[model samples]
Target: AATEAALKDVGPIDLLVNNAACTKLQPFLEVTADQFDLLFNVNVKAVLHVSQMVAGGMKTRGSGGSIVNVSSQASQRALRDHTVYCSTKGALDMLTKVMALELGPHQIRVNSVNPTVVMTKMGRLGWSDPEKAQTMKSRIPLGRFAEEEDVVNSILFLLSEKSSMINGVALPVDGGHLAC
Candidate 1:
């Protein structure tokens, strides 16, 4: 019902960002089914549900819009203790591409932003140890983690007309981490 009610009596939603996610740092052997379900519900399923509803509106309104799904670098690489987390993002990335393929004709662009690590509070938890942090940073040619603005700017670019031709791509904002 919330999805149905979104932007009702307000206006058409020209832009949508599906960024909700949850993660538990546990190895696959130690991860519980409940934890797996929770992450999938929020990260993968929620994005699908919300996007379907919003895109339905956008499709009917006949105006092209942009939808950005915030993914993670773990989607492409296996990170220790991130089995469920990585799986969720991997699923999300593919979902973004499929949505793009179907929505492109309607001028609705769908994309995913896969970032290395933004210095958010939660992001700092695992990498708080200098040695551990440096280990990851060293892999990135830029030798750093992403800032909030770095991600925000990328999303903004994807949403704007500047990226009108861009669609169905998982743009990595990984400071070259993925490249290395």
Candidate 2:
């Protein structure tokens, strides 16, 4: 209902960013049924729901739009204590591909930005332990994690006409972590 109300007021939406995400750091064996459901509900289901709603509008408008789902590097590689979170993102990446394939006829491009751990205040606080931070950073060729701007800039590029031909790509904003 809230989504419908927002769409009604926004007119035709030419851009949609399904940045839905939720995570609880737990080992795979310890992740409870309730936790898995919560993560999937927020991370995967919400994206599907929103994309369907927005794509319907784009198709109706007869003008192609772009959708950028904010995925994570964890989607491409397994990370410790992120079993369920990684699963959610992996599903999101595949969802982006299928959405692109189906929506291409309408010129609606769908892509994702898979960012490394971004250094927001929460990120910094969470990774404040030097030993843990270094362990993660050492894996990246750039020897660092991404800044918030790094991830934001990638999203902007994908959404802009500059990347008009790019679709169904899971562009990594990780500092070469995945490359390594």
lDDT of 2 by residue, 89-159 (tens): 99999999999999999999999999888887656766788998999999999998898889888999999
Whole-model lDDT values for every prediction: 0.92, 0.91
Model 2 ranges off by over 4 Å? none
Clashes of 2: 0
Evaluate model 2: give its TM-score.
0.95
Candidate 1 structure quality by residue, lDDT tens digits, 1-180: 765676465578899988787788898789999999999999999999989988988999999899999999999989989999999999999999999999999999999999997898768886798988888899999989999899999999999999999999999999988886
Error of 2 at 55 (Å): 0.8
Ten contiguous residues minimizing lDDT sum, candidate 2: 119-128
Candidate 1 residue spans exceeding 4 A from truth: 6-10
Model 1 RMSD in angstroms: 1.3
